[model samples]
Target: MRPFIASPSNARRTRSREGFMTFSPRKTPTTSQAPQGSPMLEWTGERYLPWIKDAAIAYEHLHRYVLAARLAEGKRVLDLASGEGYGANILAAAALSVVGLEIDDAAVQHARKKYKRENLEFVTGSVTSIPLREEHSFDLAVCFEAIEHVEDREKLVSEAKRMLKPDGLLVVSTPNKDVYRHESAGENPFHVRELDFEEFRSLLRQFFKNTGFLGQRIYANSTVWQIGNAHDARIDEFVIARDTAEFEFATNDRRVPLYFIGLASDAALGKFPGSVLIDCSNELLRQIQEALAWRERQSADRAETIASLEKAVAWRQTQLEDSLEAIASLRRVAGELETGNADLTARLRDATHQLGLIHASRGWQLILRLRRIRNKLKALVTFRVPG
Candidate 1:
């Protein structure tokens, strides 16, 4: 694929920077393996990193979901930042043809060797300057976890728009910086800027007719890390200017949230009542708030029930210990009695038997109490009381 000459001067200037470069190291292609193109892939050595495997899997699953919903069979697909070719390979299983481009040579080689499907191909290129020449060539484009690495994000969005068919769909995901603070202290050396929800939305609004952000994926809570991963990661999908009317009304009505799903088309503009978008946005926000409130109440009830159970357990344990001590005292008294003191021994044995029954009853009682408390908590948390 030939690289587009959209910004040759900018690329040259970036290459000539003399200061301590903050940008990640770019990969150099082998002498014999380099493609005969102006935009030689700058290897970032990211493919050799072990974390990329998990990242690739996550990207693949997400892309499959988006494509299945948006694209029909035999649609042309492009996998932007298609690291190690895993995403493209997955997409190739459903799409007519899939083209994947990456900046890492090792990744390109790995993908080429492992995934040799006939409908799939891989190239080395950058998102800011895609190698393809045809405008409106692709029906769908998937760019995941790539915007943070680029210096000029606006240009990247423009490039994506230029390459898409008028009504083509673009699915992009980025980390929610507001929800997740980079634990690495911003020293990754690869990422330029991490964006929160609003920043990302603003960037996309400049090019695409419609943009919608989806909330993060949820996972089990971790005690080791205090923060709950609630709506932490986000994906933003954009559409070109085919039906701009729908999006224009939505934007004007201020119905879209920082994270949402939206539909847009140029033909949709001025056709629908603007108030419809407002109502939809309001309804969505209300639902989200209600869900969050419900979750909080459930968590609180659980905590209270756990605390009560612990207290009951402690009390039962103390009672059992006291009964044991009493039984031990009776045995000592029987032992001190004369050898022929059958009455004293009999009394001690009876006392011990009674204590055992008490212990058993107490254990059952504690169990029942805990069960009742749990049931009550569950009911209280989940029950919708009638007005």
Candidate 2:
């Protein structure tokens, strides 16, 4: 899995998780070897980091190792460009001795600490110029997902050839350029030189004469067998017609391969049956369940929002009713004040009329005359006493 950092759209991202591929070896160190909550390395979109938990990438990467392990039993093995060294660890389980050659020093140290076995060793070295002293030492050499990453492709292939014995086999895999370049997410950024099917075959043929090719792709499949026994299996494919919805049987899977695996050796190349890795973890089923749970959560959130809005509207309606009642009370008070003002005006008129009638009857005039006579008498007395 070469790193092609991509920001897929919503639809594409969903599709990526729905499909599944993986190998389940009895003692494979793909995931369990790493410390809890700590992976050896972070996934850079280029190399397969064991703890990534991606079903598709796991199948694409580890299934190739499964094929290699089948051929590696009791043989000296060389794992070139072993990123996290999990593949080397898997090969080590079956081989007499295994050496994991890597370009990054940090990765070598991490692999050495993470995956430990007496037969397994980790060393820092480039694929183009391997650091081992012995020539033609390894019986089997496995390089995967590393060819497209190097500047010197030929030197890398030659180094693998130079390290392998005369009858040794080198199993390598590369992405099909046709499909890889036009992937839905985007082209891989880390790949320097991707090859088409023929180009890859020709490149391997330059080093070894006998070569075998295999096309690899991910597809959803159903498997059933006898409960207590194993038997031969045949593959059948069903596909829908392009023009219509009619179903038909495909004689062969001729679709463009997403990846290709090449088998090369000076001796006659060994043949193996077509291989597929099933995810025993049921990762696809889990993804579907998670999607359904997400939808339920979304629906519950929408319901809660609607209920909050309804409560706000009800509160506003209650406030409007209270305002209307207050306005009616103010109107009643204003009516009472207007009626009291009219009665007061009528009483004041009545008092003014009564005072006028009393003045006309002469009582008020007689009182004023008496007050004037008193004032004149007081003046006469004062004038008589002044001589």
Candidate 3:
């Protein structure tokens, strides 16, 4: 977990997983109960491990505790920069006593309220300049992932060495510089400094007599996730090695290792426990697969609905087009009828004018008079013959 107490400046405080540690593939018993933003530290889904939405993120964030738990057994542990105290609480299960030191006041108060065992205690302090007065008292001092946040690396390392007994073990970790630098989209704005493996080793060598590093790489099942870290293609074998630093390098950068853990002591660390913890969020993975299936079903239903709407729209458009064609045909017929009526009216007016002209002629009047006289003479002749 990230802790800001060791950072170069006070502004570098967004450090994640630096100050915290918790046992169980899930989380510690205490911090899980309290909701984020209550008396306990806020359970930011993206930042904190216990209340994280994705199980894979939670696993990757908290698995360091599993690796460190083996070494801190039955020892008085000083968890530096213990932001939320869960890491210290987890170690408390195995350690004789755990003093969780944090600089952030809210986190310290939150931790005190959430995880209060007789063996577990929370204190407000910085890792670079540890506030603990008791020097050379602790059996083991553990700083999981807080070293890189601080500006003064040497001071933090020296402080950790100071807290531990003459033969106490100092377990510390940092993001591998080569992988973290390139693998990250860009430099983290929250991080003041990030170290490569060589730089990290070089830094640790100054304070600790013998520093043995153990790499923590997360691998996902093929069926489960297409995103996140996958096994290296060049990985031909998986065998137990006596040394903690021994790891088979992946051929490509696609499967770059996530973080590195170092076990520092005066003498050589011989024959560590062969057990390696896998941060494969199988439970969360199953849930995600189910959710994906549900989403696909929803998408198919939406597509069907959209197709039906488009078909209806096409049918309506066709009907409107046919109506428009029929209206145009009716308009043409109406135009032809109007033209025929206009021609007929013009012909009738012309005929009327010709008849009027004939009636007005002088020859026509003379013919009428002649016809009347002839009829009268014919009537007189017929009457005399009859007598």
Candidate 4:
């Protein structure tokens, strides 16, 4: 039993406690729904944090593998849009200094807290507008999965080009939009546009030459599809894999998922006017025309060689015919000479036989005349003696 003797305030307080016991209030509001610039990054933090962290480690490991292959090593590097400095740590381990720039303050803070190195420094900045004052500052600049989020991709590329020294190296990686669109149904809201291989190349060729693509695993759970591009005195694209063995090129089909990885530098930009672009099909056609002309010249040279050979063959045939005619004429002359020799031999044999017959007849006649003269002389002598 409860005591009822109490004041109105005390009674009311007791009733409130009883009510509180009977019914619990809802939780206080949180900042979970706060507006952010990139929902993709937030969704990444929520749904893919564990996998992303793991992938980040894998990415660093792969970079080490590349470094082992002597693909890249340096004293200074710029990690553009560095999420949590995992890649920066990897570079700093081998490099003298690594400057990591990120737009996300939370990510920067996390990087500072989790990984601290003497050679690594984290800064908050945007890719399109770099906060650093120095021009052509770093030896290497690397950007991964950040280009698709930029509002002005061209400006971002220009800024990246501006940050590099004359021969500085730039490396970048992005998603394979074909795979993402087909697998995720184009649900990534932060992606302004899903770029196929051609589209991606077109965007990169503006600031880079020798551009290439690499396919990589983003979260390591999804299908492997990220691109890595490099920029230096000349633009290049690195092969993306655990081995970094294969490289991306123009012949790659868009139907198969692929990413753009490339290099860029001042020399590459200088050669950009001659480089290939998707929108500049006419320019490509012109290049094709030049190629065709070169081919025609080659064909013409081959034709001239063939014609010269044919002419030689024809001249040889003519010479052979003349030689054959001369041989036939000589054979005819030999036959005529043989016939003349046979006739002369026959005539000489006939004359010799006739001369022999004549000599024999004359000798016989002389013998007979001599015998008759001897008989006449004998008769005359006998008659004279008788008289």
Candidate 5:
């Protein structure tokens, strides 16, 4: 229920600046006095989508309007299965007038009171059996998320074609069966039947010779989803009759779509509407905050780790400095020992050289010869006297 300012992407903007979520009609009917006696209308998201604050239901409602508003410029638009009248109100901002047709009378009353616009009105009618009296008449007809609920889809499409002029355009959207029922065997209580991408395209081709296809409900790496990002896990198909030429309409649809939106006309549609960034939601904002908090925690953990590593490195550096000092001390002692050994070796060599020189001199040799001759003479004289 918070106010949403439209994103700046809109080239021809109207409601973006209003800063309100919805627009309603004048002479508001009393929902407070709705028929307790007459049986209150079914206005839940299950039966008809509402424009409440909950993002789960509100996202598609916003996206569909974003798409419809582009084709509705200055044209009289018929909104089939226009539940709750929010989309119709959105269209009226750009279109000349919008007629929202819902099957439930109670819902019709709610739409009348809830939304007010000069060119917007609501009525109770089924898509299969349109109450309008003319064929090929209106400028554009939009049926979003209504085809699955009806039993006779062919009759419903034919009725929409009947309401549109030969040169007019038809914009429609439906859910992709594959993605919706991928996890469940049980059927959606409101839907009579569902169709996949190929089956739905086949159905469209029967009525309109010229058709173009577009997809919606795209999602990427994040759990949050937005239009114009990722393949539509929930397909939104956009198609136009190949001949819708007043506008050159183009679309970027995934081959496997989650939902489908299309344009049907005798001519090609106009160029794709101006690119806009429409990503405003409570749930998306919540997720973004959570992600930021997680990053902060991670950064704190990294800083703690780096500090611990720095302390360890400093300790190792101190140990290395101590080891270097010890090695220097040992080298000094070894150098002193080498100096003493060199001095002793030189002294020993000098003494041996001095003794050799003394022996080589003549007087030292003569003293040794005289001692040998005197010992020989004494031995001879003692031998002769004894005989």
Candidate 6:
């Protein structure tokens, strides 16, 4: 069974619940539900769209809202910069009334059309200057991942303070610049300003009398519990001790937190424990394995193609070598023929001179005269016989 919300009894505690928390993974809307021509908001690294099929992103974002549901129960909640309204929807499941305030008109329209509940409502308004008429109306103001997007961080916090009841609590979160600067791909274009741990705590402390900070980061751990049992359990994190070279129990995670969540209020804040939401479906690991398989297939195909090209190149080289050898042999035969022709021409020239000399000589001249006389006598005899 998938555990929903852990008990806040211990700072590090785990609990198992049946089906009380019903914040299930939302499915992608079909084309019939949202027609082909319908205009939907795009996720340009700015806002988290529910339709985006990334499990890590979903876990990072949905966990915050699900945790906020604990504080939102039976209170009038105001969700600041609620881009897609999913968070507000989560709060509405328990809150007396939930209002989502967004800066983008399109996002507001999209949220209004997509998520509908009697207790939940979405409005278009800036966090710095909310358009709500009454002040001190809400019991809790939740601003998750919106503190860094606006230019006036102070005013945004002040607005949340002004709109909150005298004992209202403001649960705000922002990217930890110290850790996020290295983790993220350069600077985030959408984030106008981001606050580190000190800056975030100081800013919230200035407005609220009581402030508590929490570090949010993703970690891999083994969970153990009694079978078919629901009970609050303690959490212990162990790390290798560098000096002793042995396992040591660490107080808190040593990893730098990617985000800092601040719970600020005028009243004394209650002790809240750390919580974890398990992706029971194991979606992230599955997707990563699938991606690795696809990349391996692509690499294999590329290797095969390269090998085929190499064979083709070798065959072409052999053909060229044979053609070159054949041409060389033909050239040698032509050279020999030229040499033979030269010798024959020289012999012919010498023979022609020799024959001319024979004709001009006395013996040759007498033989020619005798052959002419014989031919003339034969011709006369044949003519007389005929007469």
Q: Rate the local accuracy (lDDT) of all candidates.
A: 0.58, 0.79, 0.70, 0.58, 0.68, 0.79
Looking at candidate 5, the ten consecutive residues that score lowest on lDDT are 16-25
Task: Quote the lDDT for 244 in model 6.
Answer: 72
- Every model: Cα RMSD to truth: 30.3, 9.9, 12.0, 31.4, 20.5, 11.1
How many clashes in each candidate? 14, 2, 14, 18, 47, 0
In candidate 1 the C-alpha lDDT for residue 105 amounts to 59
TM-score of 1: 0.45
Over the stretch 94-176, how does candidate 2's per-residue lDDT look in tens digits? 99999999876777888998888999999988788888999999999999988887767888889999999999999999999
Q: What is the lDDT of residue 9 in candidate 5?
A: 29
List TM-scores for all candidates, in order.
0.45, 0.67, 0.62, 0.45, 0.54, 0.72
The alpha-carbon deviation from the true structure for residue 375 of candidate 5, after best TM-score superposition, in angstroms, is 99
lDDT of 5 by residue, 311-372 (tens): 98898888888988988899898888889889999998999999899989898899789989
Per-residue lDDT of model 3, residues 6-56, tens digit only:
222312234433332222122223334556444744443213546545555
Q: Give candidate 1 misplaced runs (Cα > 4 Å).
A: 1-72, 182-187, 221-387
> Which has the better lDDT: candidate 1, or candidate 2?
2
- Minimum summed lDDT over a 10-residue window in model 4 is located at 14-23
Better of 5 and 6 by lDDT: 6
On residues 1-387, what C-alpha lDDT tens digit does candidate 1 reach at each position? 001111222222232121111234334343233333323334333222212223322333443344433352588888877875666877888898888877655568767876789989998777778888888888777776667667777887778878888887776766566543432233334445668877887887777777654543322121222257644333232322325545322232222222222222212222211111012234334656777999999999999999999999999999999999999998888776755477778899999999888768978789889999999998997787765
Candidate 4: segments with Cα more than 4 A from true spot: 1-72, 217-255, 267-387
State residue 50's C-alpha deviation in candidate 3, in Å: 1.6
> What TM-score quantifies how close candidate 6 is to the native fold?
0.72
Model 3: lDDT of residue 44: 30
lDDT of 1: 0.58
Query: Residue by residue across 286-356, what tens digits does model 4's lDDT show?
Result: 65577799999999999999999999999999999999999999999999999999999999999999978
